[model samples]
Target: MSSVLFHSLRVKAIQPDTAEAVVVSFEVPQELREVFGFTQGQYLTLRKEIEGQDLRRSYSICAGVDDGELRVGVRKVKGGVFSNWINEHLQPGDTVNVMAPQGRFFVPIEAESKRHHVGIAGGSGITPILSIMKTVLAREPASRFTLIYGNRSLRSTMFKEEIEDLKDRYMTRLVLHHVFSDEHTDAPINMGLMDRGKIEAFLGTVVPAAGIDHAYICGPFQMNDEAEAALLAAGVPEEGVHVERFGIAQPAAGAGQVGAVVHEAKPGDAEQARITIIRDGLKREIQFYKDQPSILDCASAAGLEVPFSCTSGVCGTCRAKVMEGDVRMERNFALDRHEVAAGFVLTCQAHPMTERVVLSFDER
Candidate 1:
């Protein structure tokens, strides 16, 4: 089981969450249930082959830890191959390749705790926040949760009824706020995008930063940054603000010098970088053009499959540890400072900084 990075999961059902989003539930066999058992706020990497192209994406788990189901939310986007296929073609009984759960978007839940945790989410970003909200509310009875959800409109908001149900169940312990960018509400605060201004206003009023023990934010890169910044600026400790942001950003230039040894090639041709890939208890050497896309691409060209999804590097599915030599990731959003310091790099964004580098997916 440890050797398998992905398992074929049968779709148990598909429920439409909104016009463009759907909640997908997977049927995990009893034997594999333990393997699929996931912590709240984690995500699953789903893969499907369409039009002869292998498409892979990561979707956050929407179900709580005690939900007794493995589920994720998918929202269709323009030119999204996987999302469109999932929304239109996927049916019950269809099998999808799902990687083991991966994420660190949640904080510890203690039963005796009486803390207030606030969540700021946007559009489909509500998925993991919903999971965390439910888990925390149920696991820590004395704790309170405030969810500030942002969407274009009520019709486009995912998990509307489900969140309402949660509100009813946790009545006094849950605070729900819906902020819409399109629809106008009776209250002024509920209108407009959940940008930095709106979030700063929120931290000053409804869910005061001083009362907040922890803050969880998930949304577009800008919104996430704004919300996190607002929380931090309002006196919330840096560690108390947990954010799950998706997008690409340039990494700061490293101070250390990376060694490079040029291999003989044609004039104006690309240099070749040799990489030793260690996976499934086997070590194999493969060479790739330094000018090529990424190390993951080079590995795939060699017919080697480890684990990967969202080639853009937002998902941590392609994470691998550097065993020897060095590799540089152009940009990274999934790995933290500690993980990067420990030599973990997202293979999709990894470029060989040394002539010969060693990568280990086995260590994960």
Candidate 2:
């Protein structure tokens, strides 16, 4: 995991992107430049206190690496405390606790490589995709990018002007397609949600799936699933497609079930289990009950500070390597199969299935 320590950074500017969204820029001090340096498509975990309650949220970086800016887009969701507060009350000069950027949602850009990349995003999901698109266009001169962005309407589209500017600047190398669900467009293809059929049509008409070097999908679960399926059906290799989900999906029945049948602990089952947590080269041993919410919750209850955000298991901030025990995850929307096979588990969703468990955050 990348550095998870929070740094006090002052908000340099706040520009409204939509009626319910704003783009915030932070002032990173020169001393912490190296610590805050982030790759494209990474995100920052912010911590704030409201009415004596602590809240943490992860926001994706929207600025390109070569742009020399550190900014994030915040869209107010219905009943979203952190997002609503940010859109309504956050102002320039206000300080925020921001963790260093962390994520694995990007492919390496090579200047001499002539690759065709596609980005499929929905609403605010464009944040990280914007970063990747801009970086690829700037860093790799021979690369071409096609963006298929979906939103409810133009009014709710964040970074609308910035995207238009990018299209104008990279007219020949960039292809832009805006799909609006609630707005009318002259082109038939620009209307309606991006579902499986629409994605398949796109692969067949607009961009050839065989010519695409990399495909990125970021949005709700259904959209991501549909787009990935279309890509795979079009003969794109599974390894060439990447996805990022904004929230965790409810686990299906019998999901994550291994060979053994694991059930909730009963009165006769072992109540307590020993847990070893390693972070920053330090080890902490703690005992937790089987009924404890999760390993993350238990670690926090023991007064051990472990980095985490979006405890719903959407963000991979709390991922750790399980060294010596078997564990079951309640839900997992962030980790890929390769990582899971390598013994990595999201501590926020993990529960001990063994008597003793040893986990490491420093193992990457």
Candidate 3:
């Protein structure tokens, strides 16, 4: 039987910056490396016990994967149980259960390619973008990076000093522009929100769209959408724009929370659907509830182990393939249409529409 060990990991340090924001770093145990190896823009799902219930939250990795340490920046939202708990109670050496890194929000740089990469981010959305920026800057010799970061004020921006140091080190290759929405400053370019006009103006004046090969955007849903639109309007191709949404927007009209109904059944019964889970060389078949909208939920409820970060379809962590039968997805902000047509299904958003389904997570 497969198992997920709830290892007690020590929190090496926690640095609280703004009132509701913190930068947390942890030292991973040796055995956890197999689970924690991640690409640039992946995130970790931290499972913590709060108020006698298991609360899970996804936090994007801010540090480069090669750093050999795990770190994430979390911005606490009002009344958010997990975020508030991490900011208020989490401390150095504190133990918590965290799932392995799981996401496809990043692209690897080719060794011989020279590209101009840009990132548009705000608030805690800078986390994954930071990882992607740092990784690309380090991996590519002729690559250049430019960041257009937005925040309410200077005090609210996370990793201010680190970003500045990066700018100084990269010198001509790395550029950063800060936009403060609340405070008016002496700098003429610093006074407005990153609306469509401002984003276009910034791109026109700073990094020309023609020179940029890739654009990564992460922020509020509207911000991401606007940034992509602005980029596309400025002659950037639609394929060059990659978006990572922080959270799901409000469900559209008539859309409800997706769930399932569990029922007891025999192992080989035809009515009992089969879910194939493959991770790290192990493969197993598990039963599921037919009426549910997500196999991820059913697997979690049945005590089957799977690698997942966000339960929502926003993060691609729970992505797997349907090799045999058909499945329908609820909402997908992570995968594009081509990926969906290629049999990729976000398990967190997948429900078997057919009687038999075979899926795989082991495909590279």
Candidate 4:
């Protein structure tokens, strides 16, 4: 559970990053500064009520650690309720509910270490990468950073001017490359979608896998995987690569809501499973059908508002511990091997494998 507590923070400012995106800054009161302190690549979850509906969405913090500010880039997408509202209506001084920063997209910064870092980001995915690059450049003065960002066009590129400013500031240490999908570039190789072949070509030339101390990739699902695969094929070790799974909101088919599913049992496997969830010192039991997607779905079916965002198992907001019986996660990208071995599972992806399962969300 990634801290279910929400704090009311006042919006400090709003700057338009692009036509479809805005950079939002929040004012953290003096007393809550410590609570809002965050790492480079973490994110903040914002909750708001719109038209009688409570909506929650997560955005990566775009400010660097040493900058001592809290900000996030919200890019409007088709049918994105919160995003559209933020870009079109949000104003300075408005109060919004925000959760503490949470994510695992950054590597530890060592001031004395001289290393080469690579970052591949696309569209608004550059939010966290911007933080990482700024922190690295500011903290580890000896390290060099390389960024290959992709977008549809210059108009759609978030943080374009800021990234350029950083390049000018650290001309010798920062390398920046932009790839546009809809716009033509002087370099023919940088004018296409950043797929596996494009990323491999960059890996082979501009950003080689050899001597890379750390690599961070965040983009659309396919592009992220493509960049990771290209780096691996180019000999980048598994541990050296850190990927943040972006674009978790799969729009609901007919409704505007996201990730809403009908709970039903599998055709042949019709046994109902008993699931006991322990949250905030309260115990609740529910009957779950095995064919359902996850325990999180079971919680939702029972009208339990479990702490979950990006129910796709990318964020660890719905992580809990399995105390009794057994559960198998359908997929996991949040928890590490050690955490999984220690009984921690992303409840969003966990499916009860036993007839009776007891899980606790209070424990880390």
Highest-lDDT candidate: 2
Write candidate 2's Cα lDDT for 7-64 as tens digits.
9999999999999899999999999999889888999999999668799999999999
Backbone clash pairs for candidate 4 read: none
Prediction RMSDs, each to the true structure: 5.7, 4.2, 4.4, 3.3
lDDT of 3: 0.81
Name every residue pair that clashes in candidate 1.
none
Each prediction's TM-score versus the true structure: 0.89, 0.93, 0.87, 0.89
Per-residue lDDT tens digits of candidate 3, residues 5-65? 4566789899886776999998887877777778998888888889998777788999986
What is the clash count of model 3?
2
Model 1, 247-273: lDDT tens per residue? 543334773322122222334333677
**Where is model 4 more than 4 Å wrong at Cα?**
1-3, 248-293, 300-305, 333-342, 362-364
Instruction: Report RMSD for candidate 2.
Output: 4.2
TM-score of candidate 1 versus the correct structure, residues matched by position:
0.89
Model 4, residue 273: what's the lDDT? 79
| Per-prediction tally of clashes | 0, 0, 2, 0
Per-residue error (Å), model 4, residue 319: 1.9
Alpha carbon deviation, residue 344, candidate 1 (Å) = 1.5
Q: Candidate 3 or 4, higher TM-score?
A: 4
